[model samples]
Target: MRPAAAGTTRLLCLAGVVTAVGLLPWLSGRNPALTVLRARSAEQEPTREALDAVRRDLGLGAGPLHLLGDWAGGLLRGDLGTSWVSHTEVGPSVAAGLQVSLGLMGAALAVALLPAAALVAPVLVRGRGSAGAGAAMLAAVPEFLLATVALLVCGVWLGWLPTSGWQGPEHLVLPAVALGVPAGGLLGRLVADALPAVLDERWVELWRGAGVSRARVAWAALRRVVPPLVPQFGMAAVGLTGGAVAVETVFAVPGIGRTALGAAKSQDLPLLQGSVLALLLLGLVAGVAAAFTRRALLGPALRDASLTLPTARPVRTHPAIPLTLFTLLAVTIGWGLLRDPYAVHTTARLAAPSWAHPLGTDGLGRDVLARLGHGAASTVGTATAVCLLSLLVALALGFLPGVAAGAADIANALPPVIVGILVAAAAGPGTGGAALAVALISWPPLAAHAAALVQEVRSSGFLTAQRALGAPRSWILTRHVLPSVAAPVARHALLRLPGIALALASLGFLGLGAQPPAPEWGLLLDESRAYVERAPWAALAPAVALALLAGLAVSGAAYAQGRAAYDQGRRTVASAVRKEAPVGI
Candidate 1:
């Protein structure tokens, strides 16, 4: 197919996907307002009939398609419907959330992009791999985990910030960092990867050879690179929306995420659908704008249909750094396990060391150490499992065109928190609830990554050359595509882990993670809050462990990234020398 035709097709497909996603809440037998009404009705019988009457009054009896069309028409006319859950106009509720979400996202984008730019500067100027790796490590740790730790240190220990709620400027700091740190890390990697390619372009080299200053070359390259990066930035925005949901819920912030969560639990379909649709529109607009911008900036070159850029070289292995970092993290986690951070030692308490009372006694005469140890294990185990499972589902679904299309629409349309709320309400708040929530929320990004990876691999010259050389399709996929795609996929997967962990932990912290007598980290933190005046360490220790684990994970990933950047630098230098040597000879 012609490149222009192919591009047009892709765009149309994406648009369709976005539309479908926007409509998913209604299609899935869950209306934001309806869900809430159902739950509310369980407590009071008249409420259900009244809600049903309200639904009818709102023209819901005319079928969903008609209702959806009316809703869309209303939206186009600047009317967002009424919020059944809040008894406010949907427009105002969404507007309020938008203000907070946008503000937070804007701050986060600045925080994320500035550091990323700084990291990229070194790569562009001198091609230092270490800087690249450091950025990657930063990206790998989840935002929630990092924020949780930051909150503890700043809010609890130092009393510098509020632990929860968005009252003022102080409320923004922790959430912004939670959103920005990983984003910055990811952006840095993108800049590091793209800048070199931009520099290698014939026009760039020609400009450089014409005695252009390094600064001018860098500026010119950035101009070209930045347009293509709009899509990524949009993706980051979407991710922030997802993270914001959990963050808002954890801190009891009055934002879209929390509202959506509340609506979902109450089965309020209207509010849920409206919020989701707004988010979808936001994503779609951003994505389409980016695509158009790229085409406009690149002009007819994108239509040439024959020109292709060079592929990045294989990432060099840095076994030592990752291994060492992993070992240190393991040790710390083990120490947290053994230290009995949750155990309470009392002189006059009935302390006994049995299978049940592993850590002896506590202030209330409870087995402190055993609870801590078990809880830590369960918390970590559940988080790890959810991350892996969610990623796997995403990967599989991402590979299927239909599934990808559905996921793209759903993800773009609904905020992660809304989805989490719906899933959690249906499943009930527990380990299963958290897992379901994570899976639903995490799958969208994972699928998006998988689709992009497949597309990139399919377009590579290596695959084309293999086909020309009569290689079997399966062989080409296995030998060429998989290896080329694995490293980036691994990086993305690792980067996603912390976010998943944080989401689960947040649920636990919110009194929804696990049942009583279970040693869940979030639950522990919640329990410790009661004793904050008497024994602050009980709360402080678990929070610290959560943060340390997340930070170490991020650091390890960054180390690997640094090594990858270093390898890329070596290849670029070698390539440049080889190209120059022939001219010299």
Candidate 2:
């Protein structure tokens, strides 16, 4: 954990990313010269002389290793090379996109603090803090879904702001709010959940007893509550920009996320690499900032106090929420399945909803309801498979630590969109590619959680006693270690399913997954974009379904977490009673 070692690790990771980006042309199993030639002049013949000329022009004649070295060297010299598609300097475009993205993210961060502040305001005024259920629910909604709804409600319905394009201040409002609201809700929920525990601490009691002002105590509590959340905030930073892929695409904001997606689609390696590098750096900088902020907030005294920062408990919600969501989704799917999704009536394209077509028809006149039902299996089912695979990978890597931890730390900085781009380059775009991309980035959170829990469990007195009694590592792990870790980690993974689905949807939206006529939610949204103004119903069905699915995941996870806690509490009480009971009794 020394500063020097950290710096070296970061440098190596940067080099690795650059190298990988450089080799993407080779990894993709496609002719780079032909791709570049097609991008430059699609009508040209693919002759040996022309291919050789293109290869020479791109410096690919020197081999991949040299190209990688050239890329690394250029990066070191503050050069981003030139785009094959546009034949322009990639640096300027990357910089412009990054500037816009940074500005958007900054505004979004400010907006995020609003809800966090709102959550804390009551605690400052009153004595206790409540983790608002609304905040938790809001946090569960995906950025793309939120962006779609914001566009529908604010732009299309209310006509308060422009729906798309990055023209002026007006365009920023919807995207910022779309990105910020969920983030704010998450931040507020984390702070609020941790606040009660911090306020109940002995130090807070002593401070209040000493006649400290309520404002000062609340401020202190906030400080204590937030340091532990630096990691979450760091991830949130990544989410704001990385999640911006869909948001940017939706709003037509020329941010780095959109740039990356476009570059991937066009096979513009230079542009794609530059955009990905920018995003990767953003994540790294956010992590550094989080660490620095955590230290600054703690100061020397508190940093040395060995304080165990309060962990936020999951938000408890009424069981009815999940039940209602599940029922609604089930009914919708069941009703849709009875209809044919692929039946195209050219005359009825973009038609309004009728008894025959409950959710209306898409641009191809394909039944929206049927597509929704059919798409569920492709989107949700794929997400479930990805989540399960991620869980298994997390378990394997988490307990192993060492190299796994180091690799996770590096990969944690990678956005799912960036991973999708790389995966698509290597394995072509499809549902499988999107699933693989999501699975690649999804395991880090679970792995980190499991790793931390494993470390804690391994060091416990009970584990020590079991070890002293000659218990095998496998036996101990299965009997004690896994039992303690599995439930919490599984619950964590469950809460993340919606995000996984969203990522897949984002990929599909970017044309990196589930091609035409697929009926995948993201792809459906993409297809509906052109005729959305004429018939908004084409877009509404999939957007609403995605949002509803997110809500279901959140509420379901909350219900399960609450039930587990209740069961644990009951067992604890029963154990205590048994311990205190008389021998005869």
Candidate 3:
């Protein structure tokens, strides 16, 4: 297919994805308002009919496919439906939120893109030490921490920007920058990495040797350099859009992100769904437009009708630490089989670390070591469950023609918090609930990655030969595509671990994950807040553990990614058109 045609096809497929994902939250049978009505009107005869009406209106009573069709058809006809909690039309509120968010996205993206592009020229010219290091360091800073620091200094200390709700465009400056700076730093690092490779391309060397001016050579390289960044930026756009929720909550911006968060907190289905759909549309439209722009810039000479770019060089590093972490986790899980986590030590209440309790004791006198061990078991167990479930489901989705990636993209576009909140609402708070929440949010990228690999391998000469020889679909997948998918899947899974860990931790911290008697890292953090000054070990142990674990996961992921990249480069270029899945929040 032609480049433009393929871009359009992909865009159309993503529209289908939007439809699939937009219906996902409503597929849950929970309706808080209806539950309230039932409890309130238990003595009334009309309650049953009212409950049925509420369920039907929310599409909870129908099959998911039927619900999707009904909702999507209504959306096509401009019927946005009324809020289940407020009874207000969702359309106007969504429109206003959309405008504010788009503006914020524009400003944040500009804040990110401009600095990145500006820094790119110098980084390319000066070599990758100073600017590259700075960008990488900035990229390493977490979004939430960045936002918190920005709010503290800019809002509280300096009193320059308001640390509260949306008042005017002026109110956006600090929050936008807080969000944009890290995003910009991320983009800058990508550009920095690409510039070195682009400059080293044989064509660039030939141009330089042919007496082309440095300025002209740089200009040509920059143009080609930007084409690859478009897709990366597209993926980044979704994460940033999702990430805006954290910033929105921190800064109290009344954008769609805030709306989504509020809806999630209250289990407000209509508002949540509408706000999520708007974010999905934003990402879908932005990604398509970016992809098309990349297509145009690539031109015929560069693109060969498939819109594929030169894949980056193999990235590799050692996996020792991460592997060791896994080994230790196995030990922890095994220990859980023998240890009793709930045995209380009342005499040791708020006790410091001792021979008996090496990790100290909580105010409740629970053995922190045992609790931490149990927490590790639970957290790792939940993470493992999420990973396996996500992969199984994603692989199945990957089998569907074009739809898997589209749906995955749509799923990826929605914020993780929104998805997690809804999934948790449906399942209720517990280990299983958190696993389902994380699994639902995590699968999209895996699905997208798997789909890309499947599509790439489907074009191989041998694969075609097998099909010509009448091999079964299942046989071909099991024998051929399945093996090829392993490296990429492993790479993506490892890379995603840190984020998943943090997300799980965040859930626990918020009291939405494992309840009391659970030593989950986030819950430990929450529980230790009051003891920070006196019994610092209460918080420090878990915090330090989380950081070390995150570091190991990142290292392991880096090594896996590098190995995948190296192996991919050794394959045929036509078979090398696989995409790097974006790390989900």
> Against the true structure, candidate 1 has what lDDT?
0.63
Candidate 1 residue-wise lDDT, 1-585, digit = tens: 334544554567656544443444445543434554555455655466776776665555666577667767876798867665556787778778767877887888888977787778886787333344456556655555566556667777788778787889888887887778888888777767666666777997788789989888878877767766766766766767766766666566777766666655565556665666555556666666666766676678564443333453333445675576556546545644665444444552444444554434434554455455666567667767776776677656645645566545545544444445555544545787766666665666666677688788898887788889899988887787666655566567776665566667667665445755567766766666555545545555566556555555555555565576788889999999898886657
TM-score of 3: 0.71
Candidate 2: pairs in clash: none
* lDDT accuracy of residue 87 in candidate 1: 62
TM-score of each: 0.68, 0.92, 0.71
**Winner of 2 and 3 under TM-score:** 2
- State the local distance difference test value for candidate 2: 0.83
Candidate 2 stretches with Cα past 4 Å from truth are 1-15, 47-49, 452-495
lDDT of 2 at 130: 67
Worst 10 residues of 2 by lDDT: 1-10
Question: CA shift at 39, candidate 2, in angstroms?
Answer: 3.0
Mark the 10 consecutive residues where model 1 has the least summed lDDT: 306-315
Top model by lDDT, which number?
Answer: 2
Cα-based lDDT for every prediction: 0.63, 0.83, 0.68
> Best-fitting candidate, measured by TM-score?
2
